[model samples]
Target: MLLDHFDYEKLLVPLNLFYDLHTGGPRRPIFHDVAATRPELLELDRNFSAIREEVLNVLPERASIPRYHELDAMQTYISGTVDKDRDWKVFPLNLMGVKPKGFADRCPRTVAILDTIPGLFEAFFSILEGGKSIPAHEGPYRGYLRYHLGLVVPEENPPSIRLKDQVYTWKEGESILFDDSWDHEVYNSCTQDRVILIVDIRRPMPQPFDAVNRAAQAIMKPIYGGQIARKLATMTPPATDGDAPAMAEEKQTDDKEKASEELAKKLPDQADPVQEWGQREATGKAPATAGHSAHGDKKPDAPE
Candidate 1:
């Protein structure tokens, strides 16, 4: 069952808060230091064509690929029923630090490139269906920074993400990096799916804290065990009666379309309030919090 996470894991809250307050990096909407990464992330850059090729191979099998929340319960709010018509799927290479056994072999060239990057925390290909809109939400920890290398993007009215006040549209082969701590939302308004290579890397911190952050991140592997289990089992083995299953899937799509219409009527515009809150927090008018509004839930939970 999909779980809408509304609170932070109790034990990890303090540590997450500590890093958010004392981290050495600049606090901004978008990060501009890709070259600062250890080893320069050139491996990913060099294998762009091969990586995109692998993603294109996976694209045709979107039905078999799991939805984001199906893999990680914590992601249910954005990848939940509210965006039913706009399916958000993922093809994961790694979650936290654990690599799914035999899974990387399917995308050998991409995995080989990923292996070269230092402090690699999470790596996956985010596949957003046409007209999908991920509600306003954020990751709690500042220990990691999110990176995206656009692979398959539609040229006409390309997909865009609003991080704070700035909206960035994805361009094929372009890279975008930012801290996910601030409330951000994504939308694929074009009537074409958008695919991007999403990776999370450890944020560079000073001395002992840097080491401490790495040790703390290890705890997330066990925490996200459910997601890993689902990812490992995502590929559907062909059954003898394939047509029946295909019909069932078609019905599911119809149900999703109905659900999305109802969801829109219930969930209010998240941008207005979240943006106001972000502005207040920046000026000390409001206290910073991991929780952000999503799907009309009681309180939003911290995401990875």
Candidate 2:
């Protein structure tokens, strides 16, 4: 569809180009070095066991957890499988700023740990079934950085993610962040499941562009995020929230710029094929418009 292609060219691509100016141009290798920034989230690592148990609470119904494509059909090309039960899976905590009232409330500690992260965007548990591989691809947007904290890393033949030419393995309780726009993919060589806590936070930028990213998010969240929230609610009945349905029904009384934000989310599958940006998504460009409500005045909705 012309619209799908448009998602690549106009709606988001230009905003992505803006990232190069501050992020040291695209030539730099992927995977950011963040040992200094590590201390803040150490609590998440210290309490890793409890977080895993919280996730384990929902593991019995793994089949019911939404696969990447289930959340955003555009990902079918990369996420694969028509059944939705097999391959790479995701259980969103906060997607595109909308919290799933039931699913998120189940893991109080995990939510609390995640809430502390700065510039938080999307937060979720990424579960990869044994011997699965997510096709090689780049995240659709460049506005936010991606972080992964290993929760259940199988020791033998464990899962590893490929960012550019390097292949990095996840170790229990350790974490790392990287620019997702760089080409990347995942592989799980073992027969055991590999689960990691995945999140995206707004990338730091100089002045005006930083605000541009937020402005874009504010416009699109209501429009594009609703489609994602609604689809996810249906896939996992238990995760459904009353607010999810109303997302599609909410009135957008804001200005045209705000309405433009909705456009990005409305046909989000076309926005960016990879990444979730809600995966309306932890997906796409224009420096990723917005993830959730403002951080300073955070209403405590829980999309962190």
Candidate 3:
């Protein structure tokens, strides 16, 4: 039934320049009511206290746990210590449809609980230290909804997330599901650390498209296993507000310039525009002026 409802067109249409030219906003739907749509997530939400207790027990020794992006400068925004802090650490169970034995062993309970959720693609514990501010960026795709269950939120002014204009604050045991493909940013303004169980859940889609998305994820399992996500996250430039227009315009201009250059290379070196125009005119087949062109105004021909 879920597969029958999946709209592949929504996923495909966003890539169209025409769609972007007309609608500059995100093409993906955002902030759907998770409780109504995914009751399984609410069941998982009930386990927050248990998960948080486990996290607290492990916190003392989590100092050795590597930061999510140890080699990335972006971690500086999360921990200030680009080379040192392990603040934005992650404990991943499943990644891009691939389950790591060690990770599953480490978080057996969480892994067991998540295994029952057909919607889940990747499951992990996300740690954010105080004062962290993740800049605005969209996910690589809109194939999944990011689910966050607040495990341990700081008491002092909790950090808030801004998904476009809507701002949300996490409370322990509460959960939110959002389309990460939309431009979003996070700020942990609290004095203490914040911890959330982050789940990348494959968005429910129509039959064929759902199958296609699942197959695609299956194919990408090796990449996740190989830590390609880490490599890509560090390598790709961060997307921010206003970047869409600038990047699109630059790309369009570059494409036009390249096309013009290619066309010039194919044209005769000795060709003259004036001579060509004169030759066409002599043949009574002159090209129409800009205003009279097919794309412009269609003028009625003279009476025979």
Candidate 4:
């Protein structure tokens, strides 16, 4: 029903502001009926049960996994803990626009499960430990819907997420689908750890919007892929001997920053029309016109 009224033929102007404006479309429920729209997701849910056990076997060495903030500087502010090993750990299946071959090889089952779903963009297993809280924030883009399947939820008094004004909890074997563009915060107050398989799926929009979204994604792929490539290059270990963990980590950070700087150079900074309009409105200033000045043109000293 929600997909019926969109203008499938209407193509959006390919601009950042257009996406920002469209992101305010009506919010869906904090959770969706996974069974109704995509029963296949349930199959993914089942596969993750085994994957969860596998993840636990290596939980002690989760440090080997790259931290989220290390991968993307934009996330530094809301990543909760500033430690090298974050309270919120992420085993990324996909980062930027590419999948890490090493990660995929390590978790073939998880990747296979992800492959079953069409339109899935980024996928990862997120492990949130007790007492950590992900600060309230909105996603940078609106073209995707964030999905979470509770793979290993706390048994009692589990953690909960607050999206906008509504609060929702995760139930193992069930999933929640919501627009991450909405302000949201998460708290894992429970004593037990919480793990979930997270993904961002291309938003299902009508005709022109979908086409426009596809075009936007295509344009972004190369930019994101470039950044990912640099990071991967540094992430791969040297053949002769691995750098000390600390040295390797420091190098990784340097590479990420360099890549980010390069990506920034490639991306044009979009002027914010909203901010410009607000400033004009606040100052009540109008454009100056010839022969109509605040000083009344001084009347040439009364033609003296």
Candidate 5:
């Protein structure tokens, strides 16, 4: 994720040019000194180590069990098959509703940077050892992008990853943010363990409204449909009491009906029957009818 907001158009030219140059040719090395682009990579390494320690200390032992697996026929038959190696697995910590204690104080700067990027509410530092490789797979959600910040890079054997056709390696303290919607995979061929701070962030798209709408739909799908609609509707300012014309009209009709009833009781039994009928019709109490009553002479009571 970008720490500073920049003109994407201006940045895209260089990015596309670099991508084209690196990906087009017969696999050429695109490894640049991570220090060249970002000087703060060193600080990230220190912070990452501190946070990792905190996470390991704070998280329950049961939560630390590695969930990723290759394949199990019995488990797949019961719970459905999951490509353990292909999928990116991590224990998410520090979400809005599920923020852990001491998280904000321990990693304030890192969290602040991540907060700027949308859809990124949590993070995880993954431990990948020798011969561990994540197979090629796309992200489940389309709106968000993923980021990898390398903390510990093995000197002898470092982890390598390929995005689209361009292969790249991780450098200690350096970070790579990319759209996980694109096909990507990782390989750790080295003898030592490779540790990286894996961050997932909302994709920076041209149309933010569409992206937000889609995110909302995904989040609300599990709950009742009507309940979600009502929640979204509440986001809009409610109708003002002063602007309720319907209520005012109903009140006026009630007042008129009360006045008519009072007047009818005071008058003679058969006085102005047609006028009373007309008033009732006007108030929506009776249907319209072609009838007239003058001087108390009834026209067959106008069919009641």
Candidate 6:
């Protein structure tokens, strides 16, 4: 049921403004007719399943309790059970971190389609069967839209999600793109398991360049995290050594002070009784005696 006629020109203006105001936009039922792509999605599911296995093996042990009820009422089956574990969650589009090996190269079709727009393409696999739900949550920022392409939808009972006013039933091969910044939740009511491939893309914004910048940040943030990404965003490359004469002069001054300090250490010390007593007091050494001291001369060492 993939949509063939996506009138980019007609939607561009609203989309752009949506991006400007919300920092992202939502398109209702973008893949209303996406069931036609089921074959491709099935293949993707198989590929992702293998990847999921490998990812789970590589991940560290889970510590936190799984939040199952967040998705929907059916989540109880998958939630709270130690047996149920989510392994190898991969966020599509190098968003916020290093892009996993083979992810970009292997999923070329998905990447190509997503590249045409601005966003990420992610895949998730759940090991638990039946009644798993993702808790209600919003997207990180308002600059992008999210899409879910159902790859492995249980046959006995299907998973469904509510996005704002709409109720979405999982249809293998169908894609649903929506404004994830809005409240949303999903539930797998079926007796079987479910799998989905998700993507987060930059919605059309007033300034295309700004969108691009945000997208790059979104991609890098996963790898670098929020703090580092913000720092990187604000960072300006250092100017070449030749660019600032003032900086050069400051460095020279620092060097001269360092040299003078070194020379002073090598020279013989001048002594004063009062100063020597002050030095001893400062150093926490016994106060210099009124008598001749170790300095060999009668005068005391000078204060530092």
Better by TM-score, candidate 6 or 1: 1
**All candidates: TM-score:** 0.71, 0.71, 0.62, 0.65, 0.44, 0.43
| Ranking of all candidate structures by their TM-score, best first | 2, 1, 4, 3, 5, 6
How displaced is residue 27 in candidate 4, in Å? 5.4
lDDT of 4 by residue, 1-304 (tens): 2222333213333343455444545634444455554455666655645666555544545666655665555567777453334477677676545777655555667777777787676787787876667888877667767877766677678988888877878766566667777788886668777878888877766666677777766655555545644565567421212324566567656765665566556654845433433344222333212232111111111100
Clashes of each: 0, 20, 5, 2, 0, 29
**In candidate 5, what are the lDDT values of residues 39-66, reduced to their tens digit?**
2333444455444444333222213323
179-204, model 1: which lDDT tens digit per residue?
87777898667998888898888888
- Winner on lDDT between 3 and 4 is 4
Candidate order by decreasing lDDT: 1, 2, 4, 3, 5, 6
Model 4 RMSD in angstroms: 26.6
Which lDDT values do the candidates have, in the order given? Answer: 0.67, 0.67, 0.60, 0.61, 0.45, 0.42
Name the lDDT value of residue 213 in candidate 4.
77
Taking the tens digit of each residue's C-alpha lDDT, what string does model 3 give over 96-156? 6556443445555677788888857788777787766677776655667788877777767
Candidate 2, 1-304: lDDT as tens digits: 2232224325577788776777766575476544443344555656767777778767656766877877877788778853244578888887667777667887788888877776666889988888887778878778778877777777788888888777788776667778778888887668888888888877767788889888776655654566667776666444333443354244322333354566666866565422323224222232111221112211112111
For model 1 the TM-score comes to: 0.71
At residue 249, give the lDDT of candidate 4: 65
Minimum summed lDDT over a 10-residue window in model 1 is located at 292-301
lDDT of 6 by residue, 1-304 (tens): 1122222234334434545453423543322221232223333333443433332332222222123233122334424443345321232233333333323334445444444433333333233346655666544444455556554566666878776666778655445545665666766556665655665544444566555546555443443343322332343322322433566567656765665566556653744333333344222243222331121111121111
